[model samples]
Target chain A: AQSVTQLDSQVPVFEEAPVELRCNYSSSVSVYLFWYVQYPNQGLQLLLKYLSGSTLVKGINGFEAEFNKSQTSFHLRKPSVHISDTAEYFCAVSVLLRRFGAGTRLTVKP
Target chain B: DVKVTQSSRYLVKRTGEKVFLECVQDMDHENMFWYRQDPGLGLRLIYFSYDVKMKEKGDIPEGYSVSREKKERFSLILESASTNQTSMYLCASSFFFGAIPGSGPEAFFGQGTRLTVV
Candidate 1:
């Protein structure tokens, strides 16, 4: 089983500023990490995933995340954020089909 | 493009009614999942089906049951709708070990159906 802990419950950032949402996971075996974003009253959309090879991975909407084995962290970062980027972000970790995470809410301010 | 579709975007059901939530996937994925999202609880897996006529109980499968009669359709049934069961229900589909490798955590999600039990 894998568990995820999002460091921040809510993060408010100014538009065009760099933002980072921290997430850490605990697993005994090899794990897969993912970041998903959800708009108001909408379902989750995949932002990025860290499977293997590169430690750094990029995804849609100018979002990126780094996978650190030792640190067990897969934090999402964006150099410049927009007002439209304000949404609820979730960091999930899974070994099989099951997942674990408390989730984080990112609010981009203008 | 992979698309997952849920039957109703919003549903209103009586407390004792037997509610059925339908889902279909166009990508022919073998794995289908049903989840319910609450304010602070996030997404809790209610049920999952790996293949036709195959179903598995997830973490919180107390009042929910699922059926997969065909390859494309999966349905979730609420035995008895309660206020606690009123939440945003999400359906997702993924290719399990298909041509796409390592797509385990990137399941495509459908526009969740918000259920309100009266």
Candidate 2:
């Protein structure tokens, strides 16, 4: 079974500031990684995915994540954030079944 | 646009009553999942189906049962609702016909149903 761990439970940042949300996973074999975001009162949307090749994967809303094999990490980063970026973010790992992290709540303050 | 739709946005049910939550997908996905979401726990998979009438237990499937009569429809049932079971329920679908277990396909999620047991 595969599992994900989101290091941070909550993150606060000022608008236009850079931020990073840390994630790590445990698996014996190769796995796929993903980041998803959910706004208040809405469903989750895919932010980005790391299937294979190119450690750096980019997604919508100016979000990107780096897949580090040795470290077992897939951390999400944004050079600059907007108020709209405030949402709950999740990291997931898949082997045969996909498992999600505890989730990180990002609050972008104006 | 591709979509996953849940039957309800919000629901209120009495404890010990049977509850049913429905979901439908139009993207012709081969996999459907039921998840329970709590504030700090993120999403915990309750059950999943890879095909019609094919179901698998997930991480947290102790209190739930599922049915998938048709390819596009998946339903989650709570035999006896409890206070602890009151939480946001999510449905998702993904395409996994020819792909490896964890290699291909991304899941699309429904808007979610907030079920409260009183």
Candidate 3:
């Protein structure tokens, strides 16, 4: 069985600032990583995915994540964030099924 | 564009009532899933169906059951709804491309149904 851990429950950042949401997984074998975002009163949307190959994966809205095999971490990062980036972010690991973390709520203040 | 649609956006039900949450996907996907989202729990999978008439229990499947008679529809049933089950229910669908070991399919999610049980 595999599990995902998201260290931060909430992150508050000012507008135009950089942000990083930490994600770690426990799996003995190889794993696929993903980042999903959910806006207020909306469903989850795919932020990005790391299937294979390059560790650095770029996603929609200027967001990206790095997959580190040695540390078993896939952290999402953004150079600059806006007020519209305020939402719930989830980190998931896919083996046979997808397992998600507790999620991190990012609040971008104006 | 892939579209996974839930029957209702919001629902209010009473405890011990039999509740059914309907999900439909238009892309003819081979995989469908049911999940419950809580404040601090993210999205927990309740049930998933890989093909027609084949269902699998997910991480949290204690009080839930699912039906997939048709290929495009997957229904989640709560035989006896409880207050603890009042949460956002989501439906998702994905294509099955015979994934290699450790690689899974990307999912498409619906808008979700907010179920409130009193």
Candidate 4:
């Protein structure tokens, strides 16, 4: 079985600051990685996905993630964040089924 | 756009009562899943159905059951609702790719149903 570990449970960042949410997975075989964001009282939306291609995957809202095979990590990063970026971020590893991390609550202060 | 809709946004049921959480997807996805969300437990899969009438137990499937009579609809049934089951329930759907389910793409999630079992 595969599992995901999100190093941070909560991250607080000031507005317009850069942020990186770490995600690591344990899988013997190749895996697909994804990032999803859930706003307050809303369902989750796809932030980005790494299926097959370049290691650097850019997603909506100026967010990006790098799939480092050697490190077994797919960390989400954003050059700058805004107040609207405050939400719960989930990192998922897809093998036969998708397993998510505990979740990281990103708080963007004004 | 793909849309996964849960029947209820909020539901409250008494203990020991049989609870049914409905999910419907309009994208004609071949796979549907039921998951429970807790404060620290991101999302634990309860059950998932790959095709009509085929169900698979997920990580946490102790007190949960699922029914999928149709491709777009999947229902999660709580045989006996308990206070411990009071959590946000989410429904998701994904397209079935090649023979390997792992090839399937990212899942689309519903708004989630806040179930309060008291």
For candidate 2 chain B, which ten residues in a row score worst on lDDT? B96-105
Worst 10 residues of 3 chain A by lDDT: A91-100
Residues A35-64, candidate 4: write the lDDT tens digits: 999998878899999999899999999999
Docking class of 4: medium
Candidate 2 contains a number of clashing pairs equal to 0
Show where candidate 1 strays beyond 4 Å: B98-105
Q: What local lDDT does model 1 show for residue B68?
A: 94
> Ten consecutive residues with minimal summed lDDT in candidate 2 chain A?
A91-100
Expressed as tens digits, the lDDT of each residue in B26-83 for candidate 1 is 9989889999888766788898887899888888999999999998999999999999
lDDT of 2 by residue, B1-118 (tens): 7799999999999999999999999988889999999998989989999888989888899989999999999999999999999999999999884554313358899999999999
Better of 1 and 2 by TM-score: 2
lDDT tens per residue, model 2, A1-110: 68899999999999999999999999999888999999998899999998889999999999999999999999999999999999999999977888999999999999
The model with the greatest DockQ is 4
lDDT of 3 by residue, B51-73 (tens): 89989988899999999999999
Candidate with top TM-score is 4
- For candidate 4 chain B, the 10 contiguous residues with the lowest summed lDDT are B97-106
Q: For candidate 3, give the lDDT of residue B34.
A: 96
For every prediction, compared with the true complex, DockQ reads 0.47, 0.64, 0.61, 0.71
- The native-contact fraction of candidate 4 is 0.67
User: Which scores higher on DockQ, 2 or 3?
Assistant: 2
For all predicted structures, in order, the TM-scores are: 0.95, 0.97, 0.97, 0.98
Candidate 2 ranges beyond 4 A from true positions: B97-104
